[model samples]
Target: MGRQNRSRKRRDEMNKIKKARYDAKELIRLKKTLGLLDAEGNEIMKDIADVVDIKTAKEIKRDAKTREQQELIYEHQESLEKGQKVKVTNDKTGVEHVFNSKTLKDQYGNYPAWFKKKKTAKRLRKKQHSQTKNFKQAWTTVNVPL
Candidate 1:
């Protein structure tokens, strides 16, 4: 009886999570259809339909955090385009290091450290899985074929 109750509770929790996700997706869809939100989910500043309809939504205000991120991205892109060296501070070690623009990205194109690690692990796993079992003996026997 206790096991059954626990299972039922877990199922109910899962259903609630699914419903919340669905509701969020539906809200986004409705906002996009109404022109209240952009394709990237940014809100538009247009006046309400009842009030003086104005196209003030063109002026989107970005928070300071987003603005700083955009600046950083611009700097990185500019550095890459101009063949200039850039300085980067390591988050873990607090050490500043200079790197060439070409060295910033991996062979697979724009990928961060964590993503590179994940891809490396996945490749190794695939390689290990692809090896077949060997039936040959370590040492050659007299009857073994060449």
Candidate 2:
């Protein structure tokens, strides 16, 4: 009786692994058939679950981390556009860098010194004020009877 129980448990384990592998294959096929992935993405996804092995788990974890980093970068771009300060702290070096209009790197590895803090509005207002000051208006004093 004991031998039979052990053999049954081993069989169950084998069946579980088979089902898991089949499920992974079916899911990949569905993604491809449904047109849910672009050509490049489909190619990448095809290899995502090549085998239900230990490596698949590691690949999934790495992909998650990469996706999270991408989201952070996008948020930083939006904040920079709105003239907000962005700070970056490197993990290995533990160095903190503050970015502003005066110092910030963009997608093309170019630093734009004039990306923010634009003074055009203030300069225009100053010019208009100066022009108004130069114009002299004549005012005549009139006595009003109450």
Candidate 3:
């Protein structure tokens, strides 16, 4: 077979293997639900478990990249604490850039204009008339028939 055909055959075989595993798991679940799980099903499950696991190329690459990013971020944080130049990496582009912790205060300086202390809205209470008068005096001044 040609290279392309061989690769396609491999992919199809992988899909079939994945489907078979899924079907086995589903079967086990269904049997358990019906209280019919038996030694045969358990044996099949053990056989499936014994199969060697395969990690995809993309996932392996992603794990390598993540470890590298974590190292970069740690270095950056360490430098900031020691007041040194920090080598920071752009997560998306995987590009590294250096910045002096002492010199960089962001574009808006150390504190932005909008960075004031948070103040909550003042709640206005309902107005009570003649607030200065004592409770007894207030009633005495009010008009009432004997």
Candidate 4:
């Protein structure tokens, strides 16, 4: 009877492990669909989960906001460095604004003009500020002669 009980316990443990793996996979898929995973395959959901029990939901919300802001700042800085011209179309206004490297620098101090909108600009500023506080930050710095 003791051996049988031990075998059954092992089987139950295996099943629990399998279930956890399945749940992780499904959560990853859902996070990807929700745009919560970066290109490096880091899952924001996992980060949230790590802090969920210890931290308040409001803190998680703030972290998410900061993460998104940082991503936008990095993307804008990269586009500016690359001297890539971009066309932004406003769905509501149906107006397309073209921004080249020079125009971007002239308008937004090394950031793109499309990013100059009040909402985005505020986020980018916050992101840049946070990044400047941290050491070991690597950014793509490209110089193109126009």
Candidate 5:
């Protein structure tokens, strides 16, 4: 097969794999809703235990993080409305740049270096996919080297 055809074939296979996983998760959820399986996907027996929904520590932390981010966004909006200037310090030159609300939207210098280099959704997805065993197996099937 040509290079383009091979790539396309691999992409289709990956999509199929992803769809299968999604379908499997959906099926498990359906079974749980029907009371056939527990919340953890284990078989439910009247003798064993009742199904329960509990939040893990990770979920609690994630919720807190989202709340914090929302608060920050609100603060930023309020500051902007009050015509407050954003101050950003350059790491190299140690110079502070105060940006007005109008300039903040159009200028990137007012943001920190880490914020400026923040990964996009697509890039984050690609990075995560590359780390998965499925991605490795798919690439190998295409006769491509890691």
Candidate 6:
């Protein structure tokens, strides 16, 4: 009886692992169909890839709201002058907040966080260089005899 119970528990654990793997495969398939996955099966856009069929409609709506807010903040900062007043609106809540550049800086320390740290092409080039160098070093070491 003890051995039978242990086998049943093991079977249940295996079934759970199998189900999780199957679900992951299905998610990958759906992501591919939606063009969220690249040809190499890696996620092209992680944000979109994460919003699979399992995500609730409310979650998608919230994500859209956040993106819209970010865009509004960007536009406001672009058009802002030192003394000019800007009206920022929340599309989701329909609330409008007005602030000049001075006021914004006093309150938030920065206008748009996105514009504060813009990633340059140089940064990407350096990142690529480091990645390739690491890969080459790894390959050479692995192929070398002890």
The most accurate candidate by lDDT is: 4
lDDT of each: 0.56, 0.54, 0.50, 0.60, 0.58, 0.59
Superposed by TM-score, candidate 4 places the C-alpha of residue 139 at a distance from the truth, in angstroms, of 62
Candidate 5 residue spans exceeding 4 A from truth: 1-3, 45-146
Task: Indicate the TM-score of model 5.
Answer: 0.27
Instruction: Write one digit per residue (lDDT tens) for candidate 6, span 1-146.
Output: 34678889999999999999999999999888888888998877567445655778999877776765555445445544366667777688795656665434323444543343345444333334334433332122223233
The C-alpha TM-scores of every prediction are 0.30, 0.26, 0.24, 0.26, 0.27, 0.29
**Candidate 2 Cα outliers beyond 4 Å, as residue runs:** 1-3, 38-146
After superposition, which runs of candidate 3 have C-alpha atoms over 4 Å from their true positions? 1-53, 83-146
lDDT of 2 by residue, 42-69 (tens): 5533444453344578798777767655
For 1-146, candidate 4 gives per-residue lDDT tens digits of: 34668889899999999999999989888777767887777866556555436768999877776776567567656644656677666588796656565346432334443455666665455445534544233332221111
**lDDT, candidate 1, 1-146, per-residue tens:** 34668889999999999999999999989878888898788999876775334544433333443554454445444544645566667799896666555445533344344446654664334333323244222211232232
Q: By the TM-score metric, which is better: model 1 or model 3?
A: 1
Preferred candidate (lDDT higher): 1 or 4: 4
When 1 and 6 are scored with lDDT, the better candidate is 6
Q: Which structure is stronger by lDDT: 1 or 5? A: 5
Error of 4 at 138 (Å): 62
RMSD of each: 19.8, 27.7, 25.9, 17.8, 18.3, 18.1
Candidate 5 lDDT by residue in tens digits, 41-136: 797665323545568999987777676555544544454465557776778899777766543431444444444334544433433444455533
Cα lDDT over the full model 4: 0.60
Residue 59 miss distance in model 5 (angstroms): 46
Off by over 4 Å in 6: 1-3, 46-146
Per-candidate total of colliding backbone pairs: 0, 0, 0, 0, 0, 0
For the record, the alpha-carbon RMSD of candidate 4 to the native fold, in angstroms, is: 17.8
lDDT of 3 by residue, 7-94 (tens): 8989999999999999998988876655465655553243433444668999987777676555544544454464456665658878
Ranking by lDDT: 4, 6, 5, 1, 2, 3
